[model samples]
Target: MADPTDLNLPEEREHVYKQQNDDVPASSLNSTPSSSWWSSLLAASGLVSPLDFAFVLFSVVYIFFLGKFAFPPQSDDPSKDPPVFKAEGIMVKTGPAFGAVLGLALPIAYIFHGVLEGDQEGIEAAVPHVFLLASQAFMDGVAYSDRFSTPIRVFMPVFFSAKKIFTLMDWVGNEFSKVCVGGGCDAAAERRVLLGRGLAVANLVFWSLDLFC
Candidate 1:
């Protein structure tokens, strides 16, 4: 017979190898291939890439055209209407949490904005009427009128005024720097930034003026 010691050594080595093979199954051997397959599917579906610059450009043009075509009746004086206008109800469907926050907050923004527009130094005691009317219109637009409680709309404008004031500070700072550096700057940058500042200031002024008006 073969040497007994050599025969036993082969058997021990074979047992160790078998245990290792059992621990690592054949299905786990090609994990990379499966991952690559999923990645390929995503790429083929065009879902993995960011929106191209061309697509963004097209979308902006499309919205501009749509706005011009669809909202003509709403604009007897589009020239005076706010450039940043948005119907509050349209935003309600964006998400429940956001809708709730905005729904709660917008009436306040309107109130503060209305009071300030009237030239009040702060919220006048009588601004709630206009705030309620505006809030009702906004809720009517969104089809979510049931969500508006009377107290929420009554106090909403103060919150909105605070928010607007916060955003206005950035506009003020930027415009002030541009004006400070004045030296016959070209029409495009100067005109655009100047116009932007004017609009910002005008918006705040109008809102504030409404308090007295």
Candidate 2:
């Protein structure tokens, strides 16, 4: 016959294993749903572009830096009291709508179209400019806020607009390089090229005016 202690050893080990499992929280065991929900949300939000995400993150950090160092809690200087430029009636209404179309709607549509057409080059070309534009918009809002001074407010657009020129050049070059095979381009391809070039040129003109005028 086996010793009684040896017989009990197996049962004790089984009991200890079950106890360890029981000690874990239910939420930890069921974490799949939480992670799945986040994944679904991210997919729906069109934030899959790492470049876009990085720019957005940078904008946030820059805002925090401006608030902490550039505009600390203190009495406002008389010289920095007035804003450098203020929008008037019609501009106040149209400015944001124009920005929304240029920065958000146009880029999303272009990107989606590129994805559908399997135009990877077009998508890559557009991403940097759109990402920078989006970040610039965010920074513009922060700069316009009461927390910052006139110089800081003016600096945001000037800096971003200047930087965007280089990206816009790349975009224009990509659009222009899209050529037809066998000296015959389909209507769809022609249309895409026109639209791409038009959009790139428009941005170039707009931002140049924004920087200099």
lDDT by residue (tens digit), candidate 1, 60-177: 3543454446333243422222322122433222322232223223323433453445423122221222222222222222211122222222223332344344334544554555
Q: lDDT tens string, model 2, 1-213?
A: 211111111011122222346575422332233223322333445643675556456656776686678765354531224333333445433544465466445865887798898877887788677666655554554454446555555566666777788878888888888785335778786787788888888877776765676
Worst 10 residues of 2 by lDDT: 3-12
Candidate 1 has an lDDT of: 0.32
* Alpha carbon lDDT of each predicted model: 0.32, 0.56
Which portions of model 2 miss their true places by more than 4 Å?
1-80, 89-93
Clashes counted in candidate 1 amount to 22
Best by TM-score: 2
Q: What is the TM-score of each candidate against the true structure?
A: 0.30, 0.63
Per-prediction CA RMSD (Å): 30.5, 20.8
